[model samples]
Target: MKLVLACTAVVLLLSAVELARPMRRRKNSIAQIYRAANITPVPEQILQVNFGGIKVTPGLEVAPEDAVDLPTIGFDFIPGCYYTFLAYNSNYSISFLSPSIVGLYVNLNGDMLADSSAIATWLGPSPSPGTGINRYILNVYKQSGLIDTTDEQLLSYQIDRLRFPIDDFVATYGLSGPVAGTFFLSQYPVFASEDCL
Candidate 1:
């Protein structure tokens, strides 16, 4: 009886450990961004977009298991959603690293949507050696006209004032390169209301 009880206890302990392991290893940024934007991040895969006649790739590559931080910059417009925040990149070129504005609309299923311009932020510089990170301040505008309640129009918007942090921009994105470095943007959805303002 003693031997049987000891074995049972060990089995139970191991089961408990197994259950807790996945939760412990879960990514942080995905949860954080989801909670803030009230949306979900797209599954890992290669996403391509065209910007300024250049092809761009954006997705979560660095720290694949970690959650990147995205705080609400501000809100504006009625019956619409406005998201403003800064994206930091320390592994790319200065010309490539800058503020990017992404505008998304909520579909009937409440999924955040993106268009071609979504990845337009990637048309610039390449990464250099020992680059730190570039910080960008962005303002995204969403209006009722752009919002399609029937999912017909498809949410659309533009990115403007794309610039790097003056002080540490150079060191962060490795802007000193003659060749452009490849960087990716997180595919996490940006949540917004489907109703137009």
Candidate 2:
């Protein structure tokens, strides 16, 4: 009888250990992708980015113009904590940062674009042909205070929206916790007929 009880306890312990393995592996896998992309060292809190009928997910392939409109960025809001939202193409030109939107709330009344001013006017994604899949990442950063920077400061290379100093910008403004992030892959159709374009 004692042997039977001991065997049962060992079986339960082994099962519990096995169950934990998958969770740990999944967390590590997610973080590794972020690190591999040089986007961040840790896994970001997931957020929803919906473009019309399509929803953005990590590494999901999407058509170019299908992602033309601004996605609806949704995430849980911390009370009184200001936020900064930005999106960039990590694959193209290193980092093609769109305008940064600052000082937003869960309820921005009606128009999110109107409620929040984009330091640089918002530009939609337009990956040039043959660029392959461009990873478009959108991150919502929790700001400690209102960001004190302008469009020029954010995009120093005014000639084109490339080589954005995202790391420097984050450090300079003391921005932390990209609280939430979501990304999708896009590329222009290289072989499509003229009508398709």
Candidate 3:
């Protein structure tokens, strides 16, 4: 009887140790992701971006240094997924920035562009006194191939820059537009957007 009790105790100890071991790695099952956002089944592709500590609500003001984690992507973000991300100030002198690490420019494939001979970075919104709530928008698009940057600042740094529309850029690759995007407004007074734009 005593021998039987000892054997039972050893079996229980082994079972506890196995239960505490780390689980095995597996493919990124996206069912949890869609459910977390309360959305429909995962599309052919989706880009998930989040600016931690940001509330997608009203009366919000954000600083430049606040960290923005790299956009979360699905398993579909393969080596072929050359994506371009742009940041815009609606009231600026009609310009856009393919924002990167330290305010430099890079193409959709994450390759650095010419004449932007600096580190890759993103310079957050530095709204002017009268800019009146700037809409700092970020749009990510799929690029079929490399697109060159024509200007040191962007395609054009002046009023003519307005012609470079993000939707059109996306459509050029036979894609509708950014699979996902999120925006936050800068307040000079109030804002026009209240959700992830």
User: Largest lDDT belongs to which candidate?
Assistant: 2
Superposition error at 62 for model 3 (Å): 1.8
Q: Write the per-residue lDDT of candidate 3 for residues 1-197, one digit (tens) a residue.
A: 99999999999999987876532111133334444544332333333434464543212355544524332222234365555555455445234432212232335444222322222345556665654655554444555655555544343433333344544544543443444333456644333556746
Cα lDDT tens digits for candidate 2, 1-197: 99999999999999999999988886677677777666663535666777789987777888876776666777776765667666777667333443223112221222254455455444656676666777777777667676644545654433345655667757766667677776777777676678987
How far residue 6's Cα lies from its native spot in candidate 1, in Å, is: 3.3
Ranking by TM-score: 2, 3, 1
Of models 2 and 3, which has the larger TM-score?
A: 2
Of the pair 1 and 3, which is ahead by TM-score? Answer: 3
- What would the TM-scores of all predictions be? 0.29, 0.67, 0.43
Q: What are the clashing pairs of model 3?
A: 83-108, 100-121, 100-122, 101-120, 101-121, 102-120, 102-121, 103-121
Estimate, for each residue in 118-192, the C-alpha lDDT of model 1 and write its tens digit.
322322322233343332212232222222233322221124323434234223322221111123443223245
User: Which candidate's TM-score is highest?
Assistant: 2
Q: Which stretches of candidate 3 lie over 4 Å from their true place?
A: 1-60, 64-76, 91-121, 148-164, 167-176, 188-197
Pairing residues by index, what is the TM-score of model 3? 0.43
By summed lDDT, the worst window of 10 consecutive residues in model 3 runs over 22-31
